[model samples]
Target: MRKLVIAISMLAFTGAAASADPIADRQALMKERGKLVGTLSKVVKGEQAFDAAAVLDALKGLEANAEKFDTEALFPVGSEQGRDTTAAPKIWEDKAGFNAAEDKFLADVKAAVAAPPADVDALKGPFGTIAKDCGACHQTYRIKKG
Candidate 1:
């Protein structure tokens, strides 16, 4: 009886500590991405100094982080530590499509980041496309919290 109680307590504690909430985690990543977007925008719009090399550096971080959101990270269904999360319950029901969306978004960002525009004017179109893809994924997968 004492052993059972200890085991239950340990399981409960572990569950609470490890609830992944990937939706929340993704939102937090986006918040950081937002800052990068703003900085990129400033450079693109001619409002700030233009630095192609700096753009590349910032983009590398976004690319690395974004890669994590693919199939496993987003649909985290069978995971005990990770757990199914605030990402709409629909995600599990339609796994393939969700993963495809992630793949497309990842591919788009990779191409966009690989070749940043030369001047502010040139950056606008590509930046907009990149941001739009981000919006697309968020809209489909993320649940609005009230």
Candidate 2:
């Protein structure tokens, strides 16, 4: 029950307001996504003890962030032109492909949440998958920024 409650509130915790400036909103969410991934990375690296509950919470956070990704709202036309945005022009040109990438990422996240690892060693495979999923999206839809 408590985990479910945490998962529910994960949206608010990760949300950066999808109201006005979507570029900012998506950027903020991505930053939070990094933090969530970092938490799991630590566990996977053996830097943190494996606590199933903690892993589940982090997984839930990923799930929340993935589920909240409103592509249409966040990637609106002209949004790709924002100076502060790292989104690639292909995001606009290849909207369907971008949407497909996002769908795969969200599905992978939900799958991790559904069958969360019981230990740190068990987490490596899923963690690798999640990392690859993010990389795939960025490769196609994001522009590198210094």
| Winning candidate number (TM-score) | 2
In the range 87-125, model 2's lDDT, one tens digit per residue, is 999989999998898888888888888998998888998
Q: All predictions: root-mean-square deviation over Cα?
A: 11.7, 2.6
Q: Where's the lowest-lDDT run of ten residues in candidate 2?
A: 5-14
> Would you list the C-alpha lDDT of every candidate in the order shown?
0.62, 0.82
* Model 2 misplaced regions, further than 4 Å: 1-15
In candidate 2 the C-alpha lDDT for residue 63 amounts to 83
Report the CA-based lDDT of candidate 1 relative to the real structure. 0.62
C-alpha positional error of residue 4 in candidate 2 after TM-score superposition, expressed in Å: 11
